[model samples]
Target: MKEQKGKQEGLQHDELGIKIRSNDNPYLSADLQKKLLQPRKLSSYFIVLIESGTITYNIDLQDFTLTDGHLLFAMPNQLLTPPAKTDNLKYFKLLFDENTLALLPQQFSFLVNPLNAQTIVLDSAVKERVIKVFGILNQLFLLDKQETDTEIILAYLNTLLSELNSAYFKNREPVNLLNTNLSKFIEFKLVVETSLTEQPSINAIAEKLALSTNSLYRIVKEYSGTSPKDYFINRLMTEAQRKLRYSNTSIKDLAYELGFNDPDYFSRLFKKSTGKSASDFLPRQDLSGE
Candidate 1:
């Protein structure tokens, strides 16, 4: 993947607050392609569906190889390194900020839990439909200004997201979301993500959720297959890796930015969680040689 500074992350933006760029469009200029070849944090939600290509990119320090018929996602603040050199790399990318997401119905809960799986392989059936939808979206994206463009584009985008949400969890174990414990489990994930920097006590989080400490532990373990403290530590380590790879921030400043009062303790925790010291977790060439 390509490495570059953060400010170059947004290759396309508009008053509609959404951007779509694809190999299918003539407007995909060489300048935009160069920008995409850098390591940076996206300031908006990003979705990429690969139709026929094999490429490797790093997302949050985890390298993902997206081949033909694969879909990958990254949320705001997550680190992304552009794909390493490749041949026949055809894909459609959609980037939209929170303001665009807010325009949709609230039923799209899948956005909150995207980290559960960053990549998924699409079967032929799903791939065909997805391609059709992307085609419509690309058309709307390329259209000249019109009063209804934004609304029509948003509608297509909403449909695409709805389809993706269903496919995202299709293979995972089915859980009754209406069950109280399961509902609380979802809430726990939200709480952890929102206050990750603060590193609040598990007890404090449980209290805020009106959950007893033991109940909180049980819910987290059952849903995530890990203890609450371990989950928080993992999230912190992931963020630390992102900073180390993409930002020029020093370790101490990075620790403070993540709400750690003791940089030393954060360092120790990071090493223990990832088996790599902060300085050593930097990006390397994609093993596949692109």
Candidate 2:
């Protein structure tokens, strides 16, 4: 099964898009998935190089079966799930933060695109080293909360992400040195991340990118089935749900805050998209502000 509520996949988060959950979490899932469509994936990047007994993992419309050792790299917001029994499933996943990634030199031509996946078979020696890094991370989690600089923590996290990216792309042929289209996709996502709030419309985004609306739509729709408007609205709704579930904001005020002119309209749209009323979506209405 998939985790519920909030945030885009990978490094994105908050009430706007898929949020890569904090790195401190050491998630180890043993639950079997029995759903048809996977729960929506967050906009965060997923770095998974784990071992499994016999399992199937589907990421970004690509399916890969694993026996003991295999690496998987899933890009942000590509729905993820498995269609296998979860009995005794074992795996490790590392989710990185976008802010941390920004510090990496633009010249560091590493594999950021999911289509450019590189896999490695781990012999005993290699496996031990990789496991050791995860072990250290687990140890860091147990350490008493210290007054460490946030930047220091981010530095450690970036180091971990770089190492994981390297391992996932080692000894692989460079077929797609990089696609210009893919670069556009990544750039589009960043623009959405930073500017979707000011109600940046499709026309505005297209003009900014110097792309015709039709051309932009064709590119985004080809990559992701949803249109630009739907994608942004879905992004908004993703955040709307998070705030509804996790915050103390009031419904009417929140509606205005999200750029909806009418409270009733926002509520209707929220329900239509999420299959639940804005009020109904809250984890506990009694806890929210009136």
Candidate 3:
């Protein structure tokens, strides 16, 4: 069942919790495309592979322009704004929820995005393989739910994610799950995301992760290129920017809502982090516009 919640259209599905769309086959209607162009929070992990042509997407307030063989991914709860026009784009888009991910035998670390890069540029060899996998999955999804073998679908899905995970980390240092420091860093990031509103102290976070403050500092710096305190502050500022750009919340209320004791201090920190005051940072045009 599809659900439209406020300005965000929730892409809910049935028990399978999966959907696929392509340029020609299973085409997207104009009305549905228009709805997708609006800024909305996605309830499922979204992936788009651009076979040809160009399209610009605004994801979490950042604009990314994708061309041939370019792939863009957005995690659940991210605000996405599709391009206004798709004149010549040939693409395959896939949406699946966390439930689908849990069924996979192995974990995909790129989903957590430790590298912080959303767009992946696929080389010729990898691009051809990816297209074949997406084509197979698209054909499988065309079958009726009752007739479709769920196991086959899962197998293809696994292959697609494996290809993506490998390409995502292509030239970068491989994500080694066995590395203790990397594992700790991922855990640290998860904790910060879940407890951002509390403005948890660095010492508290280190203790919770079962690492001393020094170890936490080293781990965070190695992965994120910043001190632990700066990383937390940057995360808070990013959330603040998202709220300021989307909602009509006042600065004082927003500051308090973000767990700041002093609005004035929050204002100063915001400026220091973003180089602009909160009032000046508000979007000139409402991103949720029709």
**Of the candidates shown, which would achieve the greatest TM-score relative to the real structure?**
3
* Prediction 2 TM-score vs. true: 0.51
Model 3 Cα lDDT, one tens digit per residue, 112-162 = 677878999999999999999998888777645456556567678889999
| lDDT computed for candidate 1 | 0.75
**Clashes by residue pair, model 1:** 3-39, 4-39
Better of 2 and 3 by lDDT: 3
- How many Å off is the CA of 65 in candidate 3? 1.0
TM-score of each: 0.77, 0.51, 0.85
Best to worst by lDDT, what's the order? 3, 1, 2
lDDT of 2 by residue, 1-290 (tens): 03211111343212221122123443334332223323346456665555555556665334676655565656555556534344555565656545445444332234444334434456666666666665554444445234333333444555555565455556753324256655666677667767745668899888888788997888677555768888777777876775666567888978988888888998988888778788876655331121
RMSD of each: 7.7, 11.6, 6.5
TM-score, prediction 3: 0.85
Worst 10 residues of 2 by lDDT: 13-22
lDDT winner: 3
Task: Quote the lDDT for 40 in model 1.
Answer: 77
Off by over 4 Å in 3: 1-14, 25-43, 77-79, 171-173, 286-290
lDDT by residue for model 1 (207-285), tens: 9999999999998887677899998888788878877765678889999999999999988988888888888956544
Cα lDDT of all candidates, in order? 0.75, 0.56, 0.82
